[model samples]
Target: MSDETNNEGLNEAPWRATILTLYPDMFPGPLGTSLAGRALENGLWSLDILHIRDFAEGKHRNVDDTPAGGGAGMVLRPDVVGRAIDAATGEGDMRPRILLSPRGKSLTQEKVRSLKEAGGAILLCGRFEGVDQRVIDGRNLEEISIGDYILSGGELGAMVLMDAVVRLLPGVMGKVASGEDESFESGLLEYPHYTRPTIWEGHEIPEILASGHHGKIAQWRHEQAVALTKERRPDLYEAWEAEE
Candidate 1:
């Protein structure tokens, strides 16, 4: 619950988030503008980019150490990362901790919506090799990945997840309808949309779409969404069909 009540005496506060990363500057730029920026400016969501290097013990200020068993790259030390998370979360039991790792659960729009209801989470962006397993185990962090591929670091994935989650925060989106109408919102692909001209290069838009018969148009959209999903992503189509 939030303190700022509206004319209806309702206080719908935004989600509160804190990010623990070695590269703090990597986060504040794009994250500081657009929708996420507006959310921060409005206090709909709060983000603290706690630098893991700040907790480093000594000179060189190294947050990562060479792999113990003769591996390729240096892994992030648990001590530095653990300490940073502790500082931001204040040793509480309720704080949500997330490790952005490729081995974790696949991220989905439904999952994004669910995480929004959770009041945000702490995103741990792993660099170099990866964060020490001990930190993840000790903190009981949930690991989530955007897809099946690997990237240089978790920073991009963390940002993607944050953007998805934060936009759902109250007041973050200019129009709620916009988010609701996006792909995967209805467990199906978004209906085809066209702007202006209606006919470009002689590829005229579908006549049924422009017919304005609301019921027929809605049905056509549903069929298109289902058909598109089946053609493009049969896996999603399979899951959607199983439910029905």
Candidate 2:
């Protein structure tokens, strides 16, 4: 639990996130701005950062070493990372422990929702080559990948994951519908939106949107969402169709 004062005064516990990373300063980067930041201030959620280097021992304070069986880069030492994990999660903490890696399970909106329901997470950001496999296995860290591409480090992935989960926290967004109607929430890309201008350059807002009939507007939005999904993301469309 965080010591930060809660302005909202909610009786329930705030969602907690403990981040274990070599670069502790990278966190709450974008998370400290916008809706997520406001939520943090209101004590809807909390963030704790643990510097991996803090757990290193010896005069030089080394936290990584050359990979076993000969690899090109250094691997985070199992002993050091294990110690950090232990410190982050005291006895009997049920919150999921996650390791951000390219090889991990692909992250999705469904997974994000599950994490939010779990109330909190312990995130491990790997660097250099990667964390020692022994530590990853022994600690039972659930590996997660944000996308198929490679990143310089896992800090950005952790931020992305947190951003997705935090927005769904109670009172984070102004309206419940705001999060519900987003892309992937219903297995389709969201329909295009238009604003007061009504016309932008040569383009005009669809006439149906201006119509007052609620049923027709809902139907139009669903059709547009389906069409857009089929064109832009056939894979999602296929899965949605299968379930239907």
Candidate 3:
């Protein structure tokens, strides 16, 4: 069940990602484009797609079965998922094992940063009703949810998580500062962005942004970010205020 291949270059222990999912072909889809793609090509990171069904039992290669307590949908078999996890990550692997599920703790920028620091992760893409709870506990997997809503499967969520983490990897993005000023990095949504033409549809870019004063510009951005966060997410604004 290991279709694990490292696109590693010499001496570079790139951030590794081993995704356990039924849809193995869905991997590196968008991640193989843009900054993440370039990083992968540069050997700044590696991807290993572990097809969960590869470890399925029986002639059908069945990975999921009816829900244990009479659910409307089937649940992924713990044994199958367990086998996939084991095959992807061998002994002594220090990477954290994660399961993508709506029931999990909401994923955040802070968590992504932690995973980036870890240099890798083992992501389990749950399908059907969900993976068996017992296996989740036994494997010590960290469950994560992308949002409050549900998706058809966890494949997209895993990709999203990886995309966020990969962009922060050293040398992945054009500028390290890009990640720092982003939304949630400073407990506030990002400030507005403006570009040349300066006047978009008769709306001028903020006057302060055009002032050419670095200190003033920085102050303006901070103020804008604070105001925006307070208006849109008062909870975050409160937390940010508490820290100040």
Candidate 4:
């Protein structure tokens, strides 16, 4: 990530982000690659990193402690984490503050689009068991989870969320419409994709794709998308049907 501060030349920044984590080095990790990296270099967005431990009171820089009630792991202290969040945001900052957690509302393409439209976000990457719930409630943090499984830390989840959102920002992707029909965008999984070498390993590409009939091709893609969604994700298929 850039050494540039979040408030650096505030007027010129198109998109801004601030990550609060115990492991600041993990940032810009994958975001520093491919489209996201290029966007960062082009100033399409700006990232600011904040280390949560910096707010800890003791010499050990202990940001977490044993859970109050009793648990297998530690919980981030509310006061320290709250201070970090306040440092990133001041009065009247409208950017949505997000916390990456397993129990959060599942992240969706619609949510990603909303975040992109906002042009910025403050992401909190929790470690240990989780953050003190008080900070989450007091800071008005929108908790978001990428999937059903768990990760070792929220840094990776934050990166995943950022990558998903950043690619949708203006000029990041080559074609704007390219993302519109992707998985979950239409409440259905995307259709299968095929390339040259029509026949590979004795498996032939779908005939409709090769028919050169634009209308039929479009119909075929829509049908395949529906079938795939219904087979792979019954929940999404049901929602799609309900919408229709």
For all candidates in order, the CA lDDT equals 0.80, 0.91, 0.88, 0.87
lDDT of 1 at 195: 65
Query: Of models 2 and 4, which has the larger TM-score?
Result: 2
Q: Judged by lDDT, which candidate is best?
A: 2
Model 4 lDDT, residue 203, Cα: 99
Give the clash count for model 1: 0
lDDT of 2: 0.91
Candidates, ranked, lDDT: 2, 3, 4, 1
TM-score of candidate 1 versus the correct structure, residues matched by position: 0.91
Tens digits of per-residue lDDT for model 2, 97-190: 9999999999999999999999899999999999999999999999999999999889999999999998888777766777789899999999
C-alpha displacement of 184 in model 1, angstroms?
1.3
The list of candidate 1 runs beyond 4 A from truth reads 1-10, 91-93
Q: In model 2, which range of ten residues has the least summed lDDT?
A: 1-10
Give the worst 10-residue stretch by lDDT in candidate 1: 1-10
- Local lDDT at 101 for model 3: 96
Candidate 2 wrongly placed segments (more than 4 Å): 1-9
Give the per-residue lDDT digits (tens) of candidate 3, residues 1-244: 1122333332657999999988989989999988788888888889999888889878798888898668598988889988888898887998999999999999999999999999899999989788899899989999999999999999999999999998877666665577789899999999999889988788898899888999999999999999999999999999999999
Query: Which candidate, 1 or 2, would have the higher TM-score against the true structure?
Result: 2
Pitting candidate 2 against candidate 3, the one with the higher TM-score is: 2
